[model samples]
Target chain A: MSQHYYEFFCPVKVVAGKAALEHIPYELSGLSASRPMVITDKGVRGAGLLDPVIEACEEGGQEIVTIFDDVPPDSSKEVVRQIASAYREAKCDSIIAIGGGSPIDTAKAVNILVSEGGDDIAAYAGAGVLKRPLRPFFVVPTTAGTGSEVTAVAVIADTEKSVKLPFTSSFLLPNAAIIDPRMTLTLPPHVTAMTAMDAMTHATEAFTCLAKNPLSDAHATAAVRKISTNLPRVMENPKDSDARLELAQASTMAGIAFSNSMVGMVHSLGHATGAICHLPHGLCMSLFLPYVLEYNLEAIREPLGELLLYMAGPDVYATTPTSRRAETCIAAIRKLRDQLWQYCELPRTLQETGKVSEDQLEAIAHSALDDGTIMFNPKETSIEDIRNVLRRAWG
Target chain B: MLAKRIKPMALQARRLYVETMFQVMGRALQAVSEVDRSVQEEARALPDGFLFEMTVMPNGPKLVVEHQGDGRFQYLTSEPPRPVDLSIQFKHIAHAFLVVSFQEKTSVAFANDRMLVDGDIDRAIRMTRILNRLEAFILPKLIAERAVKEYPQSLGLPEKVLSAARIYLKVATHFVETARAS
Candidate 1:
């Protein structure tokens, strides 16, 4: 156990594998919820991913009261209120969120409004604000990355204020998470690579950060091994259902781990960089993973060394001496990054992204220092330290 | 009956420690808001009239401070007040003792589910930064390094000694004035 005292709670009933989508209506019926409101974006619907979920619900004698597929990539407070209105007007008894982080987060925010009886979400925009359980909710993630399906937090952009309002409560966790391979079969190779890297980063940071304990460590290691072994195979063959399923499950596992143990500087920097330069989140995670690990090397040396066993198989772990295992684990991540770059031109550096300039590093660093996750990092990072890491990661 | 009696006695001791710590913390925060550059910068980032509170739940010592803008914090009463901008409440007296005695860092306490914050997280994070800076000045390096996420590397021994002395003097003077007023 890394921590002497820790608390881990994941109430989400995860129903994964071949017929996970088919089980959604059964799960809903069990919750005594018959009229579900489906919240998703046009992209997931355009790709025809929502079809199976609808079919399953229809066949199970459930009525989808309404399908609001207009969720944006970056959901907003206004969007949440709009969805809440639709949910009420249609008399939805439950919520089934489909697609990735944005839609799921939107659904969670909508649940708060509908259940808590408020149009102003800003009134309830902090940690531990919700006092009661939300309406029955379920998530079927289309993207294999965000793991937002199981997290007890949601972030909705308050555009007028130009800030992201975060709501965190155990009440925000989904009643169940439905993970199926069919949802991710159409994901492009680059997306597959980047999202897997996001999961890998989540697991890696969870295992190494402060607050890590036995239970979260178990989930983190399992997630790391799954992503490491299966990411490359999926990158080679995107249509391979087994690999896709493993990656999706790994994403959820990583989500559960980080949600319990919390993530550290990699996420801090990723969030800051995304906020500043408008970069895709998965890309930012892939870009900064190695540099943040290297910076946190001394403070997290023991856990990083232990992670080598999961990142690379037993052959590599058994051969590397104890002192060198930490760096070797980082080297393995770097190799994976190189492979991802080859597979789909994922940017490995801030300079390569062509969106961020040298001057933006300071802003990113300032923003990163203010991020909540920075407190959980094993090593205390200074603004100058973050700037130095960004400079190193720039080229 | 003996076990029940002993529990209250133990609770009384822990409550005193927490109360004393809260008073000292309130004074130190008032001092740092005036003297520390980092705290001044952080305070400027916060909205004016931001009320911050630290307390133990269900009936324990409380410390409330109001930001009066221009990097100034006025220590409010120890009594619980209306909802504030940011409030960090230790779940139990023992948890407060762990943090007040420097046995556990603030972030560690949060990770252990020993405390809960009710307010905007961004403002809460800034409040934490201010607290970290306050801890760096008020506490000895060995102890502060454990209490805070990062002890300032810029403060040499001489600077730390001088800062601690200044903060401690303010804390003592405030307590003396309060005693006279009472």
Candidate 2:
């Protein structure tokens, strides 16, 4: 048996529940942030979730110098830098990121750029590139998905190059995460389904990937089982506080799992596909999950089978061989995607996205080949295999 | 036959580390009588009617095993005993157990102070191996059951509400997933 060593660490204080957003002042107080920058996107502001947070902070004697609500979807480095400069100009002592991944990630980038005084966000790309911690950052995720509040990585698109720069470091982890399902109550059905599937993919990949260890396995398994059970419910009833809580918890757990154990090809292909096609990351992930799993079955069967047992329950594994379990898991995932697609009206194929084509398959595959995540896949993958997976995902 | 008499709670307690401390121990003890016949035969050999005192502490849980039969047989942790035996510091039990289960190395964790064992070194090694097998077979089921009970609605939700919730969760889950995948 191969002896695998694993360590789990997510020190960010997670404040979760129905009115968990109210706990932000307490978390920020602990960080000694007197004047915090409330970083968010227009969507969150438009939804009016920022009001209570601002009110809560004001009631707690915390001053908010600026509300940078310019963050856009798939936030670019230019936007982050602009915000960072604004934050610095305002002399804000800390950051309070409120929204989905884009704003949270943009806040992380802003923290890095402002604190480290770097002109180019690209200079800090890759793991362990940062020499010091960023600002004292507190994250409140408006969406129930993306557990960006706790992860130690950020993705900022470079519009000039059309490439997403992934800056990773332990230092990028937020000081605290407030995951209140109420923040996600107003989210539309399509966004909810896609983000839930994104959370599911995180848990699934962490459970079945090569780098998975005991701690990650525990978190991933719990996350997958929870998301599988709760995502649908939350999608069906956004007002169901309990289901919303479960998805929030699943999102955080999946975040913790993949952050520690890492993810696999589904993500690699998704990243490349997202960057190239300008499709949403979750949409790309949901579209490619089954195809990539089908491609990886030969190498990932054993673990994937274990995951299948966790996902579909033991009955599915009772008569199936371990090697066959992987395929079954892939089929199960595809079935879920199909169900989700019908429910959310999400695009089921690359062609449905209106941008991707068979002609770009090679480029997408090549980009995936160069992605850092592919290196951790259980099976060795090549550009050719990636091309094949893309073609299959094209439907 | 004596093993048949062992309370279901005791069996579940034996499998406590598997997942939820409550459910696994409950199931293992409930099913104990049917699966392993040797447990009863071994229980017959225990001293004081197979009574074993167990103490779970921060370091490690300790069990004082006494023999009721002729000195030829030894008792450990309410189970039948083998030839060798050892005691571990209570705090290191879980760590030691995990290391032995995954690494298949009994002494390194103990020697490195990640675990500490007292008594016969040989017995400690044997116990680790047994615990490894016990964890592997029992943990997954326990974990699965716990997850199922924890989140029952994941199968499918009402179409109207599910459609709405999907949008938010999709964005959130994607942002985190893509970052980690990268």
Candidate 3:
């Protein structure tokens, strides 16, 4: 056998259980935090998941000094600055990011500002800009997807320029991640399906992308098995805490896998669509997963076949050679998406989200072509190819 | 013909060693070196009329190397032999080779759970000894070359002092980790 090598590094302490939130204080205690800022969206606060975290912090002798719950779905750079200002004024020693991608991303940005003392979020938009470490931060994801709890990236939309800026630094990774299934139990069916699909996309893309290594592949495969097995079960019974924890753990695993290895065209396209059309990030991922896989099948067939075997088992591709199984994997993904669509009644096309049109195709293609994730796709995708994928994804 | 004198056992053992060795070497070169096109081209040029094939796996890539000793090595991807001269199973191909070579982990493939090597114990021992000596000489030069290209600031350091410090730190850290694990 040919020799191979891998480097594994994810330092996020994953606290996963029915009452995983209870472990958050213990996790944070290691970081020496006495006062923490609870950062979340108004939606999460409205859903009542934030109260338990606050109570747990109080019971653990950790003070919640402030609650910045103004984060929106597509978090803007301005929102991050505002939250950072609030954090400073509150004199909080640490941050408890308690929402989905937006609040977590905002918390990351806020930490950057609080530590680095930068006004313009654009200044540190690229990779490896932060030379110093940030404050102790913990993530409590209320969705079973996004995997933001473990990722080193924080994407913030620059509303003024109308583009999403990805801030990446290894130091931006959270100190700990609290994945309580109880937090995700109340998610609406549409959000649940879209977010779970996002997790699956992360695992699948991580498994199939150019930067994939053996370590990433193992994590991605395990995540795919967990998500594929648990997402549907949780969908059937939203209050199934066991299934919810499985999905949550899957999302966390996918997050760690993709964060180091990177993702591919699905995320590139989703970022562009989310930026221009103002759709939910996970919803955009769900709409484009199968389409991008089909488009990039020729070049990424081998890795994609590995994903198929891991997700659906070897029998799914028993009749095909490893080289030709990419199409089979894409077809399986389409079938799964079809089932999820039927289950959640989510939009199957970009047009269903109200932005798909012949006129908008050029902008969507241009945006996707400019996204950094597109570069890591195994195939060389031109603007026209991106346009084709967008047109096909458009209903 | 040269084939008439070749023992099947030796041939199989050498083929397995070369295959695994080249695969690990190629992955390490790719990880630390920025010259991807040149490195891939060089990897495609393994000596001894050898053929190489690689199969990407969930844990890592498996490689098969075939050689006729006619100044060319052919590479192909296929199943590895159950009993071979030396077998190494690592958590990932990149880490297995890089950590062993650059991080100075002596026989990490045998010691760590991330990698396992089997068969022809004497040959394996000889190969590991040779690799360790080669790593001792080559790793510093490789790190220096990469540092100049990757981080220009390293070029200004006083050669003796900087080299001494780096060696000391690496050995110290390696010793501590190895001790803790043991």
Candidate 4:
């Protein structure tokens, strides 16, 4: 219940829906660039998602001067430095990143070094260090889970030190975020479900966290409603392009929502568990989400009630009593977890994650308290509270 | 020596804010801990030799506070001070004020790139909680609402008014004594 003086910012131009990639040239043209460097991971290329970017370049009468497709899953400073060198050598004017969070982040880091002329990215580790806007950059996210396409910060792994270096600036935001369903159409059902759930977590946390504002609430609510309506359809039929588009839009909207408002303890816990246990981020999100919702149940009941209405739609929301609506939201997420688990073995309990041991719970809790997202949790969490949440999440 | 390279007029303005922040933070360390046990509890969670420093971008008038054993904190010098624990450096004067003036919370400042921390981020977070308690005691309801991540749900109106006034008196007394000694 802090003050009403929340500042809002989202500078990335979004092009979402069918054939959005085709519109990339127009967006780049406005930035006064035609020759762009295409950056992606080998996985996205193997998945055939790069075809659209190639097709768009061909149709737009522009050729990518060079392609750097070996971006690692956890983007490293060395990788970014190398990519910056290649971009400079090829005389590329702009950057086009096509993949999930890693490539988008790598591209952002490379853009920083390429534009700012720094050999070491660690120098730009903290926020506001970059003095000006980076080179014209765009992101084509192949996965719906990480909204790195629209986010203003990049967390690139420091392979040497085994830590993630965070680079943040309004300047780090991409000039555009292109969300084409065609790009994410080939994602497997498990990946689809997990990423969509990740978007849902972003929206939920944004709506309920201490930083929740009127504008962010609107976007988060819309994102939750869209994800609720479309996640099932996309799960039932993976090829449903319409459902895919809605999920993509939800992910992007949720990204904008959380990046501005920030997420809560769920993300803090998720980040710790994921980093420590080497679990996938979206998968961690889906597992810890219900437990977090339950933990913040009383503190965020009003927003939880509203989310119940959004997730369940009008008909069910009407019948649900005010006292029980928050529980209803938690139950619905539990149901989704059960379904996703049945489809693909997504662990519902922390104990179910074979990688995590009982002994590691204390370490996870301690690490979570350090995470930047912990500040936004509605309840000021103590180490004990974190441990308790982990204990409940454990079983 | 502080930012000697900055323009004189700009430096003067920045120093006003910096000096005021120093006075306020010093008062908060003493007054809030006296009134609120939560501040003490939060501070007690940190290790001894914990240091929190604030310096404006490109500059002088930097302030560093170190945690004395138990839950007490006293201001220290800007230099190594036994290998500092947590340091928040602002990129510019306006960026520093964004948090100092209670316009944004520390976490929001971190998220927005308004400030940077160079050591022990978890310990930094623990220190932030302690700072939040001080803010509740020092700032009025309207101003505290922006600086604190979450306003205390149960602190009654009368005590809030009483604590803020107490903090103001203590801050004034602190500055007067420092001026006399100087």
Candidate 5:
């Protein structure tokens, strides 16, 4: 139990393993939905991820009324509106999001519109605005990262305003998350590495950040252990179904953990860097995780040290002295990153990406301070401190 | 029967503290807008005529303020005629007291899920920064350090003392006027 008062919530039903995708139709029907609008991206579609999903639905005698697969890598308000229109035009009674973060977020946004009766998502922006349950929503995550499937938040870019609009509510959670290894089997090496690291970061932050409760710690530690043991094996053999399934389940557990406990400075800086440098979200998480742990070392040492057993297993954990466990945890994360870089050229630093300039570090720092996630960081950070971290991460 | 009628809302001591804190916080927003450069910068970043409100849920003390552009703010004596751009509602009076009495920093209170904000989060973050700046200026350094995430390092002791005096005087006058009005 936490000494401080805390609240934990994750109502999304998780359906994982080999038969997960096949069970989606049954889950949708349980919600009294036979007509589902499938939302995904071209990448997942092109990768033939939809074939099995379509086959499953058809075999179950549930029709996918329509599919809007043109979703951009970053879901936009306009795209959401368009999907809402198509969802209405097609008379979609439910939604099935079959991709990564974008499509799932877009589905949640579309569910808001169709269920709540609104086209302008900006009207519903902010926390606790959705006052009712959304339409039947199911997620089939094609990637192992971005626990958007179980999370209660969506970030849709408002292109006209040049700002990311965040919509948060427990209502945004999917009715069920279908985590089938078949869907993620086609994920490229780099994406697999980064997305797994994203899960790693989520679990790490959830365990150490403020708002952490006993329940969240359970999920976070389990996720960390799963990812720590399985990520390397999956990277070595991308076709390993068991490893892939473990990774996917770990991602969902991490999602549940972070959704309740919430993330901290890693996410704040990662979001800022993504906005400024256009780096992938997972890559930013990987780049910033170690540095932030080092920065919040004093405040979060006990929890960080406790995470060593989960992250590095008993051998390393038992060997490391109590005084050095926290630093050893960070070293273990750095070691994992080094291993990932070898597996796939996942950039270890901002400079290696050939995208972020030194001059942009100040802007990133400023932007990060404005981020809501910063409030959850164990250590209160100054712009100078953030800039120092960014500079160090710049390599 | 009378004993049973005494409800949680009738906890007079907590109510008085919450009301007094809200009153002082309202006045302090007005004073800091005039005195603190950082508050002004934050106000300018907000949308024009942005109304910010802080209240406790289930009918507790409420404090409302408006951004009058160019780093100026006005404390509304009554509930605003229009919906606020951002509103942070503490789940209970005790939670509000925890934050108001410097027992919990605003960021910590937020992280602890003691409060809920309705409206733009970015603007809410901006408002929190403004509140942090106000706390740094008005509260004692030792207390302010506990109430805010980071105490402004550049705020010298002399400047803090001088601003705290001016702000407290304004707060005192505001309360006096409220007393007379009531």
Candidate 6:
């Protein structure tokens, strides 16, 4: 119904495949940068992912001034400030973020501070605030999740205010996202399953949300089909480089799709859950996918019907009546979660996580209402409505 | 001292005309939607104390409509008398008039990055539904076809002429009152 007006933007040049890691320096050369700072987290380092990145940089003849690998799970403004200070001291001309969401997000904020020459990055909060392009930046995600590589939005926690500040603009997008399957080869099966489901949520919710347009719809549908085909294959063999590349490409496409159309209540509730429980974001995303689909079913049955056609091939799709498409989509999502749970020991409910407590339900429900993504959801999501969904998903 | 220069994207003459038109339509819509035997159930489903604002942004010449709880709305003065619960902000003057001047459909304008919503989503939805009701009354069949998701039931030619005349007369009276008060 909201098809009346929409605009899509994804300027990130994505390099995806087994050999993509070797091309990072060439791409950075295209951005005219020779000295780049490598930003990562301890988890990525402990997993021995940073060594290959360093070797590849050396092989590309690009100088690395410093490897600042202190990013926490949720990047804060203070951390970004510190990272920016390091970038300056090292005289790095560009940033190369290697890891999951946190390092990529920290690099985005650091680019803002370093380029804008502002000590108070908080002044750049909210949507459309960044007017100028940022320093040449790139990301190499270690997990097939969070598509932070291509999105034009960054969430940095304001440790002082105890709130998350969202900075959005075309400027926040990275110059390139290198998706080498080697980057995620070390990722555990559980992380692979959960993050793949997160990508599925992004693809499905982007398709069904109010901002859906022709361009984003194609990307979202393609992302869903890719994730559906490759998730189980990667789960079966975590070391398969080809399967890893497929899932990684799926995340990038899904990220670009959701970045353009934005997401709906699944993301809103997931953010609330992650904020309240300090749980892994992908776990929270996978847990809420089916429930949010059902909640939005009545309002967006047409889009959901279309998604059923994407997720389920024409064989099953043709047999199902048009009226049953929404149900089929919801069932398919639940089936996927069940498969992941049985195969990988992934938690299907919030209680199974053991990090989330029953007392946190009210706070999660209240916080979800404050999340901005709910605005794009096709259905009206009230606080009571979020509370009910949380209760049902709480197990 | 530097003189203040107006922003290039500031709301312009066309936007003012659009505001004036909405002021007229704000008063006319409730009565028109309430006309007997209309099945646009959502059009007349507005709650009491609801406030809708159309702001031409980043700075705005904002126009507001407040539901009076009697199946009617009144256009408040340039400065709203009360807090606006929902604000639909156009990116600039060009976008503001594209819908306000009937050159583009409201929904289409929204999809085209012509506008942004800054407040409650539910109230925005309700206001869009109400605006469609007014569009049915105000716009010609060709324009209304593009504007509304589903066309409201048609009024006969004889009734259409009479209703249009009556609605404009009431709108004229209200517009004059607004002008004098301002």
* Predictions in order: lDDT: 0.89, 0.68, 0.70, 0.83, 0.90, 0.80
Task: Write down the worst ten-residue block by lDDT for model 2 chain A.
Answer: A374-383
RMSD for each of the candidates: 2.0, 20.6, 17.0, 6.3, 2.4, 8.0
Candidate 1 residue-wise lDDT, B1-182, digit = tens: 99999998898888998998998898889988877777888898877788899988977788999888998887875553566888889899989998889988888887788888887666777888788888887787889988987788887888777877888888888889888888
Residue-by-residue lDDT tens digits, candidate 6, A177-259: 99998889879989998899888889998898877888899999999988888888888888888988889999999998888
Query: How well does candidate 4 match the true structure in TM-score terms?
Result: 0.83
Q: What is the i-RMS of every prediction?
A: 2.0, 17.1, 18.3, 3.9, 1.8, 5.5
Give per-residue CA lDDT, model 5, range A1-395, as digits (tens).
42287788888888988877889888987889988999999999999999999998899887889999999988899999999999999888999999999889988998999999978988988788899998999999988889999899998999999978889999999999998999988899999999999999999999999878899999999999999999999989999999999999999999999988989999999989998899999999999999999999999999999999999999999999999999999999999999998989899899998999999998899899888888889887778889889988988
lDDT of 4 by residue, A36-96 (tens): 9999999998998888789887899878889999998887889998999999899999999
**Candidate 3 regions with alpha-carbon error over 4 angstroms:** A1-8, A118-123, A158-164, A314-324, A352-354, B1-182
lDDT of 5 by residue, B128-161 (tens): 8888888888888899988987687888999988
Listed in order, each prediction's TM-score against the native is 0.96, 0.65, 0.66, 0.83, 0.94, 0.78
| Residues A276-352, model 1: lDDT tens digits | 89998999999999999999999899999999999998999999999999999999999999998898889899998
What TM-scores does chain A show, candidate by candidate in order?
Answer: 0.98, 0.91, 0.92, 0.97, 0.98, 0.96
Write the number of the candidate with greater TM-score, choosing between 1 and 6: 1
Task: Tell me what TM-score chain B of candidate 1 gets against the true chain B.
Answer: 0.92
Q: Going through the candidates in order, what fraction of the true interface contacts does each contain?
A: 0.74, 0.03, 0.00, 0.26, 0.72, 0.18
Candidate 3, residue B57: CA error in Å?
33
In order of lDDT, best first, we have: 5, 1, 4, 6, 3, 2
Off by more than 4 A, model 4: B1-24, B27-51, B54-63, B67-73, B77-121, B132-181
Candidate 1 chain A weakest ten by summed lDDT = A1-10
- Can you give the DockQ of every candidate in the order shown? 0.64, 0.02, 0.02, 0.23, 0.63, 0.14
Pairs of residues clashing in candidate 5: none
Instruction: Evaluate candidate 6 and give its CAPRI docking class based on DockQ.
Output: incorrect
Q: Give me the candidate number with maximum lDDT.
A: 5
Model 2 per-residue lDDT tens digits across residues B86-182: 3445343455344423432322333223433434222343333332222323434333322221122222335323432442344345345546876
Which candidate number would show the highest DockQ if scored against the true structure?
1
- On TM-score, the leading prediction is 1
Worst 10 residues of 6 chain A by lDDT: A1-10
Question: Which stretches of candidate 6 lie above 4 Å from their native place?
Answer: A1-3, B1-17, B21-54, B58-60, B63-88, B97-112, B116-182
User: For model 2, what is the error of residue B68's alpha carbon versus the real structure, in angstroms, after optimal superposition?
Assistant: 80
